[model samples]
Target: MCGIVGLFIKNPELESELGRHVSAMLLEMSERGPDSAGAAVYRNEVDSGRIKLTLFSSQAQPDWSAFDRQLRDFDAQSTVKPHLNHAVVETSKSLQQMQTWLQSHAEVRINSSGKKIEIYKEKGSPASFIDSFKVADYTGTHALGHTRMATESAVTTEHSHPFSTGDDLCLVHNGSLSNHNRLRENLRSRGISFQTDNDSEVAAGYLNWRLQEGDGLDDALHHAVEDLDGFYTFAIGTREGFAVLRDPIGCKPAIIAETDDWAAMSSEYRAIAQLPGAAKAKIWEPEPAKIYSWQRQ
Candidate 1:
């Protein structure tokens, strides 16, 4: 089974150090899925009244280096230097403006952005990739991640998990979504855009578009369970909170662990046990079709 993992820390103060812990936990579970890996880590900076956006190539291009320099000149308060094919930019403008500008380039995929959050993910095992930014260096009250063993599509960065359906709303799925072709067409008819043939990205885009139209996270997730045909477990991360759901049949395996300090869930208990103090933490499995949600404190 593809490995899926998530963490939601109650105390914003504790969010700072979680990246190292969570990363360590994820690495330990990496063996479960060696094909490709990705993560969406949330960073909440006291609403300094800024919009932080993450930009990356939809596919690597020859102009990336030039574009990187151009982006840095765009009035960002600060910028994270490009790592691999992605960069994080903290700006004062609305995400729409940033998207509009990036769209002009045609080579960039505004990846994912929104209120105090910016995330980038790539295909390939984290062990082999040198992430420009480390989670330990970033501060967020919540985050979610995944590693994949491709079952339907080729291994490419765009096909990686934690597909950003929208600014602040992203999803990492661990199972094949049957009937996704038709579902993709259905969603496209409604104006939702997709970047890859990957079903996981399609699921994320569909749910994000639904939420944009006013569907609650829970409702969108329930709709996914009923409408999307397949066995899947998904971790959805949003600016305010995150939620995980298992398909009605629960064909995939997942386990959860909790502590007074943090909450973590993954496809295996070994993943959760990888976290610090987890040996003494309370751990259990989320019942199939059940939902779990937590917001920053």
Candidate 2:
């Protein structure tokens, strides 16, 4: 079991508190999945020509300055912002180029890569994880949070939800992907890689694959409904906004609500209730195989 929450801020005034809202939603959904939690915040944007990579250091203590120096060696103009175990590195180099050089540094892993997305995860309760990352103070255009029960994969921090396989794109899923093994191999052949045996990663990889093939978010999700064999509900976050989709069987629970200021999706209504405009938001359960998305102009 797992709980997924997403928020897209429509009003610029609410952008500064994006993470506060997401934190409440995530904590509210913790009853469904309290063991591990993660959040992908779309903020701290780099220049359009550059990219931001959130890196996680597995070492007990890492020298962020040395890491920054390595990045600057790759791109003299690169910069870094260090958090606890994670740091956001910005550079003009292509992702492939960065990943190629990082192949040698096994302890530092790329958590998420984009101009505006920063991801943080911990193998603890939602409340503790949020506090550790100071998620409530994060500001962003949109955010995706996930609390996981980890039925399939190990309950490790790296195996947590909100997996990102593409730039400025991340996915939080709340159900099992039945054919993930086969799908994983297929994606690997197509040049997509997996860091864990988690099926949710496969789902994220599939969407990234579709996107790389020239499909937009809506089109990629439509393809997902047909090609992905599972009973799942997914909330996907991109640089522009977020999307929600349920599988054909729709066995998993999902609720969507939208108001004048924001749109939110969660595994249950209680989580949505944590939002400011929930009392008057237009709420509904997403239809089977239907793709619902919101984006900024």
Candidate 3:
């Protein structure tokens, strides 16, 4: 099993509290997952043309200067900020070109990239890493987090959840997909590459492939329910909005709470109860095969 938490703030006043709220929610569900933890934070975009790439290196002390120089070789200007085991690089190059250049390197892996999204994840406990990373200090419009128990994959950072396959689009899944091996082969044949063997990564790739075909978030999720064979719950976050969907059988646990200020969802009510106005929020379990989406205005 895994723990999933998402928060979308509608009130401008609550924007700065996005990370704090999400951090609390994630810690609340720490017992559900002890293998790895991750989070995708979406903040206001200061540079429309630049993309923020969150990268991971197996080395505790990575050669960030060399990586920045490599980006410059591609005619892209960049700024690198190193965290504990990950780094966030903001570059002016197009996403396609940037990805191509990064793919050639063996040591670095791109976690997520977009104008507003910055992803941070590692192979460790959520409660321990959350404070060290100062996750509560981040400010964003929306955010999603995952704590993985590692049912099908190894307990490595690469196998962590909140997988990102496109710009500003990330997915965190609970439960397993039985047909993921078959689906992975199909996606690979379509020219879609996967970084990890994790089933959750396949889910992200499937959504990215659908979105590339001109499907909107809602439409893509509708197709996902029909195409992907699994007993799962998905909490996806994009630049435009946040969405939640459950399999037709509804085997995985999910709860949603919505107040005038924010919309929050988690594996259990205790996670959402930590929110500012959760006491007065309308809370319920999402129905099976139904799409619940909230977009930013």
Candidate 4:
């Protein structure tokens, strides 16, 4: 089992408070998953043609300056900001070529990439990790977070949740998948690669593959309900929206609340209760096999 939370700010004036709202929701779900925590935030785009990539290193202190110089050699203007063992790199190079360059560097792993997304994750309590990362201070239009209980995988930073397989797209899962190995193999044959053995990562890759094939986020999730076999609830984040989905059986717990300013979902209602307008928000449990999405207007 795991905990998942997502917040999408529909009101432009409330965009600056996205992180605070999400952080509080995540903290409320801490007991559901105490092993590791992760979050993906979609902030303002740096530039029209630039992309942001979050990279993680196993070392205590990575040589970010050296990596920046290497990117410059490829004619990519870049800037790096180190936070704990991970760094966020914004560059004006093509994502495909940057990924190829990163593959040649064994020490650095790309955690997430997009024009407006930045992912941060670590192997520790969600509360403590939030404090260290100052997640509440971030400003963005939408955010998704995960707290892992480590049922199928080891407790490591690489195995954390909110896996990102496409630019500005991320997924956080709250249940187990029975046929993930089979599905992973199928995706691999289609040229999709995975960083960890976690089933959540495979789910993220599946959605990424579908989107790459020209399916919209809603269509991709609708297909997931028919193709993937398991009991799961997923909260997916994209560059322009957020989506929530559940298996046909709907065994996993989930609740959603939407106000004029924002839409929020969590594993439990308590997580959403403390939001800005919870009392007046429309709250309900999402139906099984239905995709609930909120997009920026």
Please report the candidate that would top lDDT against the real structure.
2
Spell out the clash pairs found in candidate 3. Answer: none
In model 4, the Cα lDDT at residue 38 comes to 91
TM-score of 4: 0.96
List candidate 2 segments past 4 Å from native.
none
The regions of model 1 sitting more than 4 angstroms off are: 44-49, 58-80, 130-133
Predicted candidate 2 versus true structure: per-residue lDDT over 151-225, tens digit per residue = 888898789978995889999999998899999999999998889899999999999999999998899998888
Model 1, span 120-163: residue lDDT tens? 56666765532434655556777777778888998887787778
lDDT of 4 by residue, 1-297 (tens): 789999999888998888888899999889988999999999868788888899998887778788778877875578888887888988888888888888778888888898888999998999987998889998988999999998877888999988996888999999988888999999999989988888888888899899889998888998888888888999998898888999999999999999989999999998998798799999999999999988876
206: Cα error in model 1, Å:
1.5
Residue 288, model 2: Cα distance from true site in angstroms: 1.0
Worst 10 residues of 4 by lDDT: 68-77
Once fitted onto the true fold, the runs of candidate 4 whose alpha carbons sit more than 4 angstroms away are none
Query: Pairs clashing in candidate 2?
Result: none
RMSD from true fold, candidate 1: 2.5
Of 1 and 3, the candidate ranking higher by TM-score: 3
